[model samples]
Target: MFDKFLSIDEEKRQRVINAALKVFAQKGYQAASTNEIAREAGISKGLLFHYFTSKKDLYLYLYDYAVKLITETIEQFVDPEERDYFERLKQIAQVKLSVLNDHPDLLGFQKTIFFEDSAEVSAELKARSKEIAETAYYRLFADIDKSKFRPDIDADRAINVILWALEGMGEAERARHRALGIDLDIPYMMEEFDRYLELFKTSFYK
Candidate 1:
């Protein structure tokens, strides 16, 4: 689907991708301007369109690219053999933080996609988000050591609750950082996340 974009030299392709990610992350879908993306990429609008037929195409392509990159990075770093659920989650979080630090714009673009309400792409984004969430849940949790969970508790339910709590916490943290106009403080965020994991472990573990 992106043969033209993929065929370009790596440096040029990355420039376009980085520029588009920055614009979309900063201004969001509806407000993001192709002209600005082109300017930032050091290319003309016509050339940008030559690679991507429309802004929607470029946005969706970036979504797929960012998700694939992040997922692959996590798979590379996370220990598949570790069966302790909380420990695995912590490892995954660490991997994600490292990726975010390396590609801040990619993470920002993903965050924008999460809250995007644009009519042009909202439905598709929601569908894609659901698919990704389902896949991630299975891949990340399916092999966990359920025996460690409290015998009185439903392991599946407890796992879902833990995931939901952590997800809500993440959203709240991001909102707070955005409200303050500050970059994510990785150490502080990880410390708080660890505290939450300890609480969940106490509640759910045997």
Candidate 2:
């Protein structure tokens, strides 16, 4: 659908993409307005539809775009050689936070697409989400230095616990930010992650 858009000016294409991301992220697929997206992107609603056949088409495009961007960012920044699981997770978190800082709507946009129930493309979206998750899980543990883990702890379980704890902490931070009506502060969030990483390392590393 975006073939024509891609063939056009790169800057304008990105403007529309970002505008759609922000709107869909804020209001979800069912509620997002093409008019608002076009206005935000400084394009006509007719032009926006010209680029994408419809709102669903634009949304699916954004989903693909967001996943590709995140996958590329993780691949570029997360070191494959770091053997310590907590350290690797810290690196992943840092890269993720940086991306979220630059594209504040991306995470929200992804979460919206993954959980949306009423969309016609829900099945395809779920499949794409699963594919991304599987790929992420594989990359996260692949080639990690397992020797650093304490011998008594089951490596798989340890990794699962670490993942759960980190996710919980992140959710807590987001909740706090929401309650306080403050934007996510990357520095503060990273500091919290650093503290968690050190604690996990102290407990889990041999």
lDDT of each: 0.88, 0.79
Across 1-206, the per-residue lDDT of candidate 1 in tens digits comes to 89999999999999999999999989989999999999999999999999999999999999889888888998888998999999998898888878977887887887687567689998988788778878965687789899999999999999888878877987788788778977666689789999999999999998
Q: Which residue pairs of candidate 2 clash?
A: 83-145
After superposition, which runs of candidate 2 have C-alpha atoms over 4 Å from their true positions? 1-12, 22-32, 50-57, 101-131
What RMSD does each model have against the real structure? 2.7, 4.1
Measured against the true structure, the TM-scores of the candidates, in listed sequence, are 0.84, 0.71
C-alpha positional error of residue 50 in candidate 2 after TM-score superposition, expressed in Å:
4.5
Clashes of 2: 1
Task: Give the Cα-based TM-score of candidate 1 against the true structure.
Answer: 0.84
Off by over 4 Å in 1: 170-189
Tens digit of lDDT per residue, candidate 2, span 24-128? 989988889999999999999999988899888888888888867877898898887776677777787778767877877887786576346665878878787
* Number of the top TM-score candidate: 1
